[model samples]
Target: MQESATIIDIRHIQVGYGQKTVIGDVTLTAGPGELIGILGPNGSGKSTLLKSLCGLLPYSKGEVLLFGRPLLSMSERDRARQVAYMQQEVQVSFGITALDAVLTGRYPYLHWWQNESPADYAIARQYMSFAGVGDLAQRPLHELSGGERQRVMLAKALAQETPLLFLDEPTASLDLSYQEEIFRYCQQICREGKTVLIVVHDIRLAAKFCSRLILLSAGGILSDGPPSQVVTPEHLYQAFGLQSAVYENYISGQLDIHTYDRRSAGQPGKAIHVIGGGGTIGTIIRALRENAYPVSCGILRQGDMDTAVAMAFGTDNLVSQAFGPIGRELGEQNRQKIAQAHYTILGNLYFSQENLDNLKAAFTAGRLIIVEDSPINSRDGTAGEAALLYRQLTARPETTVMKLDELLLAVEKRSL
Candidate 1:
């Protein structure tokens, strides 16, 4: 049901059109300063929920209240001023300048026949800059890229200066970089004490960015809460008919997911060591940790992922050393740790001359080195020497392009 504490509340709403019911018995709320993401497969009534909450669609049953008052009872200008709704793929037929488009957000504050005040223009300019499109103020709607247009649309909504902003697939057509940019912009807005509700297709991005996630099924809410609590394997299976594995990030302490393919059944293979800077080792650490491996790493500064995971697991197996770039002393410490490991793997990291001494220790110590597909380069003279040693150890493979799964299998088999 509706929550009084929430800025926007929907209580067991049954929304439909004409004689067809699109959503049934749905209820969710967005509290102040919360960024809530609505997620599910297509035709799951996600759009219907957005429409119902925005007062664009009438519900057959239940209630929607904005700050304890009925949605229908609110005035049009008051509602528009308090709520900003941006639908997915909204068409802009005219060749209007982006500035004019965004300035439309001030309509609720202006009289029907009166002109826009200087304050309205200032707000439009501020929002345009905040959305990172100040230079595109004069650009026409049709002249922008898909991502640029999406950002302009967001700027227009933000110009509305509403307490609550609703977006439908705000990052739908954008590339990964633009998708993150949009999510970052939304996060910034939420930080400013505004509540944002967005529909998202990327589950991982939603999990990382949204404070709360609401999952929709056939026509109603299947689950709702923090992403860690709401988006689960069972909920995903129920919504999209897919199996997935959920794990906690060792560093960020957030939920991360990996889909499971039933066609390739069986458990993941053995323990392995990831030897790299702690800064970028978080994902690898969490992935291995979830697979039930006794993982360890070191030669890290105090604030790296290695230190975080070590403290989190408190297994006493993982060791963290001082900060600074890897040098002779650091290499000696890492060498001892690698000597005890079954295998050592490296990611796409640039090797420093100072670190070359350390990598050479792994080679002379007879440690199996598994590197990514990237070419190895070194500022230090030891890389070429280390390469020769690695060549002898992995002679059959001859290349550093081993598939992650295949590499894990080989390690497990050799250890057995």
Candidate 2:
């Protein structure tokens, strides 16, 4: 890739309508070949700020310099060659082929009576390829799916052959797969020595794809840095009114954001470990965390909401893997973690032969407290031996066995 330069410099730009400043004194810079994602809640002036960049909205204060020159002083042709703006939702108010839509980007270089030269067509085709819509050139905008339409819009922007591109909510209409595809395409665009500034709501997608993220919140620039540095949990909560626990993926080793609906009222006084899967222990983890108990979980890979919830609580003790059938390794690891806990409560989950070893580990460690009737269905598909072992523990003089409600009541009584 070529070395990209700083093509956009907005220093202290205040944008708004007459007598009202929606976004005030904003300063941001986008370098050549940089993909920057702008994030903020609705009505936070993200769109207004973007409009200010293209001279569609007049600035109330400050200056915008394009390639070291004042934006207001640039000629139409010069400005068109430098910047391309793609709106989030493009309406097909008129029936136009995708090719025609893209060809409009060449108007800046055309005379009133002149036909589009072969170079313009070649440029349009190349951009369509760059945006992954070369095959849809003949299709009408109305005939495209949401994702396809978005790509076509992107192709139009790219067709302008500009170093700077602005996109507002480019992935808003896309499904998960399409959302990822669009972001990946944008990354490729940046790699080609073009700077693309986009507004996106999915912080995780932006973090994974964009080189930098600019968080707009509370009428100001909250943060501007690389994704890892800028999209911290604190910043996310502040910017989007979301409370999240950030985690490093056990498999991907990348950052994942898990938003929690309820906040722990106080710091947990004790660290506990949970052992169960198949959505059996998710509520338990939440309850423990809500009651100010620090909890860790493990060995439940995919199809386990428990593992997903554990990530949300920022549980320090999580051992998870991708989706697959439960295996001996995971069972053994879960058993080891459970054995290490100060106390263990068996969730109302059926036992399986595969996980029988995990239960046995708890038995060997003499730490077993089973939820009532957990082993009733154990013989069907679950680990009946584990259930039997649990029954033995409950029957023992030292073990405590209680139902879920009883457990909560006991905790409440103790608190009083």
Candidate 3:
């Protein structure tokens, strides 16, 4: 292929079985050096699309092009030479050594009736080592663990050394380490100018490793772009009917998903204002939202984890700039929200000079629920100022102090 040329061009393709359409009007283009992830809920035709692109399944409408040529027009050997596809599951009934399985990847290069050469063995061994399955070469496929078998199969696909690689849930049954290992290998391969398209169920893993993402719905592509663009709340809801909070995890520095189900819980029109920061209130926000409570949060910094969770659940949040103290305007806004709420919750949050206003706002609530997982003095970074304020709030007539679990139970009971 020429420089920056498209390796796989799928144009308005529709694939089906026995008059029932599975993939509908899907169009996508992939060039070299790109690692794209296909993500969606089950029965969204992710596997069907992969099979159609490889010409293993017939497309009822539209066409596919490989290397600027029609996919159907290419010979099987030519197609195999250019594309390496790994299916979702491999079942071996007969006994075959792992080494022999990996050697089959060289079939495209060998002519009919041609015997395997020493160079082929070298190439197979090299990829087996690359896939971290070099030691399993002599083991029978049936005797290997699921993870071991997956690595061996991945080595076989890598040994093909094709420009375009299609993997349908290659990490399905693998352990956590093996799943990450496979994605890491794919990342390195993409850097060498090859393209990889993977059907992945783990949205967080795909967001972390894949350069681009294609989100599919029941009908067709819901969104297609970089991870930031494709893994939004709107696209996730449209594709999977999932109400989820998508945010960058502070520790992992990757996009993470927190899903909630609010359908069964009827909306209870009770306003609850939450005061929290430093990632202390994420679980509370989710629990309240899942219980169908009308929730709002305030006095959090712009980049705070609490702010992200509040925004994800469509809460009315009052936020300030990062590293800056809560100003009069935001503090007053939070107080107003707290005064309007039926109940206010103070999460188990560490107090600093910057967020001291959050504790002051809690006193404005008609009824207060204080989540005291840790002692007040332990989280008192304000030289006992916050602890003094917290003690006074808890001493109020309508205040109730409880642990996190008890607080959740109280909220749930109040919802009923």
Candidate 4:
């Protein structure tokens, strides 16, 4: 009775308690195989929206259609047959066995006084095994640990076998590994063509697993799309009032989110120019910006990791074509930014003929700080030609050579 996938079409829905509207105006539709994560700050109506969809909370405005039928008109039995919901908290009786608790999901298909069927027990056991809690089926629900109880709840929801599932913070009680496992389970079920809408507070976790994301703010939808589009700095700021750096982690190949606060940061001062390349500019630029130094990045190739990190940090990029030799126009532009900077930092970079212009441009800085994170001999890609110029720059009176930490402290202490 509950083994078919479904679609939900909600139009201009307004949900609230009495006169206080929580979701003022919202419209969304979900189809089979979609694992959608609803994310927002607290009081943004994430849980309320899930409840409204599962018919636990009524919408006073507009309509919700489930499987092409109006949700309000569906009988309670029919609604339960189509959707399975796992809420945030559960209060079961003291002595109910885990298997018995999961059997409750099969009640919609039974008569008023009927006991659970053999088939129901089988289904309950199946999902309990799937949720890695089959061995605890004989244990009392109240006697189980929080994570065990959570897995039992998951088993119950899975036993429903409904086309659409809603999980509201189901992983709240689970540890990090189990937290990820729950989402992984949801993803697997959705791949089998079920629809799942999860309400999660962990934004990055949601981004890593959910096929799509909906960010709510001020009782309305702020952003809705794939993680790459919705988990952006601007959207996160609008939704949570957080100043965040959202970037693709080069190593993990996943989105990395770091939140920063400028409240205690220094006032923006004279601009610093960063000569960044070969993946060494990220830490340098990030440190400069965190201390409220106005920094610009230059001579970065179009597709370099440097460009990506710079864009994420909102640095002004002085551009050059990727894999192309520095041209006169772009070389002049690099010099101009270098000349205007109060101090310029030359990052530890691989030196080559194509990027020789960047080394030359570093000489234009009124004052210079060169990061010697690695030995210059190994970084020379121009057969010692670029290293010779680097040696000359290090010899200048205004040039200061320091390790990365020393440079960071100098900036933090405001010592030129």
Candidate lDDT values, in order: 0.72, 0.74, 0.89, 0.89
Which portions of model 1 miss their true places by more than 4 Å? 1-4, 264-416
How well does model 3 score by local distance difference test? Answer: 0.89
Pairs of residues clashing in candidate 2? 351-382, 351-383, 352-382, 352-383
**Candidate 3 lDDT for residue 119:** 94
Error (Å) of candidate 4 at residue 57 is 1.3
Expressed as tens digits, the lDDT of each residue in 16-50 for candidate 3 is 89889989899989999999999998989999999
Order the candidate numbers by TM-score, best to worst. Answer: 4, 3, 2, 1
**TM-score for each predicted model, relative to the true structure:** 0.66, 0.71, 0.93, 0.95
Top TM-score prediction, candidate number: 4
In terms of lDDT, model 1 sits at 0.72
Better of 2 and 3 by lDDT: 3
Candidate 2 at residue 56, lDDT? Answer: 77
Model 2 local distance difference test score: 0.74
lDDT of 2 by residue, 1-416 (tens): 22436688899988878887789778888888789988888877888888888877888789998888899888877788788899866878457988888898888778889889999999989888877889999988899888888888888888887888899988888789878888887888778788888998888888888889888886679999988788777887887777676655546756777666444445444456666676777667766765666666755555456676676666755454544345666667666666667676666665566555545555643445566644355433653555466667667764677787776664433331
